[model samples]
Target: MSFAKVFRTRSFRDVRQALLEREEIALVDVREEDPHARSHPLFAANLPLSRLELDAPVRLPRLAVPIVVFDDGEGLAERAAERLEELGYTHVTLLEGGLQGWRDAGGELFKDVNVPSKAFGELVESERHTPSMPPSQVQALLDREANVVVLDARRYDEYHTMNIPGSISVPGAELVLRARQIAPDPATRIIVNCAGRTRGIIGAQSLINAGVPNPVAALRNGTMGWTLAGQALAHGSSRRFDPHVDDHVRLVSADAARNVANRARVGRTSRDEARRWAGEAVRTVYRFDVRTPEEYEAGHVPGFRSAPGGQLVQETDMFAPVRGARVILADNDGVRANMTASWLAQMNIEVYVVDGLMPADFAEKSSGPSARHAPTPPAVDELTPTELRTLLQSPGTAVLDFTTSANYVEHHIPGAWFVIRSNLEQALLKLPAAQRYVLTCGSSLLARFAAPEVVALTGKPVQVLSGGTNAWIDADLPLEIGETRMASPRIDRYRRPYEGTDNAREAMNAYLEWEYGLVAQLGRDGTHGFHVI
Candidate 1:
């Protein structure tokens, strides 16, 4: 059947103008979280094609309106429309041109609350807020520049390849948790850098969100930009790690233990209580509904604001700046949100965990969001061999070696592939068709997250080696531990320079402001644009 028969459609330019005019249109985007972050049209809300069906029941009611979706390419748009139709929605349309077609139509693109793109833009244009040292204005200040801390927020391996002379290694993903360790002196002007732009900007802004006293900014793009500005990149590695974890900030409990289910946090309340909180005051209690944004907008607790679990945990101070104020963390799936609360508790922040608390949309609608980020915990103390062995028996069970590819080559599991924390998901996609998914990280945290993503996408059951690779080794499992890699990945590097061959001046200005404050500005737009296949 033709997709057009199933979906109404529109041109990108038409949709763009409609959004700007604030017409009653429901702009929907169907793409994964990360890709949506990379690039998309302005004002597109991400529903991700995979979640279109699950979200439709709630999705339709919010929009007594029209929805438009896009895909990277192929018939994904039509397929998605079909799924939406199955749920009985009748008003969605496809973008006439996929992202590239829109791009061809002079379709302006946005990084969609993307920190990296802003950071990269900042790196390219140095005319912004970079604690300037123009020869004449601050010659003496430059001479007396004895107090500044620089951090590199790219992957540590990238740090090993090349870094700024005195910067510290802090992965962007780890910034909010480890910021204090990197910049102990709140008085210091904290500067962040990355190999390119995004991580540095995201990292810097995350610190500000966490309430770091230092005025944080990206090093205008990072080592790449530094080099373009006639600076040299350094070689060799530096000590990397948060200086320390607060001993007092010990884990009261970890994982999906029963205690995790009952833990308390500030904003969280019983379902009845949450409904009451929503009625009391919209601004007093910052109720963060920790579900995907699509799920939130379709319907949420009346007074609640939207913040995903991972981003919220990493940016608590930014969302709720008033310390000692209340915060409620909620999720459709209770366990993972509770697991998060366990960590937040040790962070010494007052918080709460509420189960069965949902938006008013839940009462009005009958559907749910697609697979949530929650991990289902089995009701068992030790992982049973039966479960473990079944996961191993599947030929397609992905064996991800968290160790470096080099370590992988030295002798790892025979069929397992090498995937570092930074690039694990991208690799998972190209794996041979598998019946189930298995993962190995140093411990279970990475697996806990990654394995579930597969389930969400492919609906496959996933398990990580219980103790990670160590568990495999402890059991004396048989397979290659270290046998030199058979081949190297065939990949090349490319750079997209500031192609100002044709662009409005306002965009260029926004790009410049973005660089100076990349860290502090991610997702501030509070809207999204995306197209994926």
Candidate 2:
């Protein structure tokens, strides 16, 4: 019998009550991104079964924390629970009826990814009446060369892809820290924008909260609104705020940010207290270095993961899935952590900013991927890139790519079939009969875990590409592009209408309409424990 049969289950009411009462619970959606986005409870975090081992240890830290896993109808919930059990999770339970159960029980299901953070952004705008300027108005000012500065409150990559002409990248949490320097003149008009709405409103409000002496407004609906108004966006713009800040500006920014955090009842803890909290087996504590990725890779605290402040606020559910868990944020500068904690506190999360840490304290350093606590993968036969290339020439040999659909479409070994690890059984039935099989993904870490399972299913010779697709690329081998051979549907990632430049006008308009109604939906759902100050 499967271990899933032995596991207990929680009804929708039980999970909802836990969230309403602010009790600790991780209502995890174990399906891939597309399915989860189509329908799911408001607070459910998407932790796909394919990447569970890679993310679970970091997102859901405590083994004893109550966890309720679910899937729409793909039979992934039980498998996910079993995997969690094998990973030593003590309190794993399946959602009684999965997604269907929630719907039948009158639970509100949300569409799109990052629902909590996006909904919170809408709520913030409703409550604060965050000021905004339409794209045309901002464009007029820019065209006339008025005393206005456009600050793009998105990740650097997002900003580089497309941005308002003459705008500088000042990602969300950095607004308060860097805004003064970018527009030192107090009378200059400051406009913030994101791909859609969340970061723009949050960034503009952050400057207001920090008591910056400038007029501020968000670019309404961000680049989407700009596009709707038939405005052209500058591509490949690389303008950014200077990292260096004067001592006076840093001190003022720190004081103002701390004041906002204090108003929101965000706590401050010493490193010792934070360490104690992390050591508690009963409590789930997430330690994050809310600094830029480049800075984090240079040096950071020993246990803290790199979660840039802007993205953390934009996707809180992704970083800390277990609702009501303790979250501790760190940064060498005093501004970023406190500013980020203020937002988390208003979102009803128990958050803290670490105090009394100097540059010397960030002793631990890494120049590679963040450390992950995945289970030891089963040993499998390995093949070098040259060997795989030689093997591909032989008949009756098949190569399966287990990377994301997006990556597979971008580039892969010639004639490789794209497959989803969770649906491998069905995927294999679509492939031609082969005497041997080979598995590979981005870095071979995921492929290593799937090799044993494939070997068991195929009952044939199986091997993994030594370094996965990256190694093949390094070998300068010929590659193919597009969805040439797809064994499974490309449902691993949901294409957000707000990302990239080629979005349809209808989809972009519909996305804005959805955001407009989020506040009303929040009221209807009644489970978000938010308290905006």
Task: Report the lDDT tens digits of candidate 1 across residue range 367-404.
Answer: 33332222243321224334555566656566655554
Query: Mind giving the per-residue lDDT tens digits that candidate 2 earns over 1-533?
Result: 63436679999989989998889999999999998898889999999998888878878878898999999888899999999988889999999988999999999989999999999999999999999999999999999999999999999999999999999998888899999888899999999999999999999999998999999999999999999999999999999889899888999999999999999999989888998888888888999898888888889987788898999999998989999899999998789999999999999999999999988879888653343455787788999999999988889889999999999999999989999999999999999999999889989889998888888899999999999999999999999999999999999999999899999999999999999998999999999988778
lDDT by candidate, in order shown: 0.51, 0.92
Candidate 1 wrong stretches, greater than 4 Å: 1-5, 10-14, 21-39, 43-66, 84-91, 100-106, 110-145, 151-189, 198-217, 226-533
Top of the candidates by lDDT: 2
What stretches of model 2 exceed 4 Å from their correct place? Answer: 1-4, 367-373
The weakest ten consecutive residues by lDDT in model 2 span: 366-375
For model 2 the TM-score comes to 0.98
Cα distance off (Å), candidate 2, residue 347: 0.2
Q: List TM-scores for all candidates, in order.
A: 0.42, 0.98
Residue 373, candidate 2: Cα error in Å is: 4.5
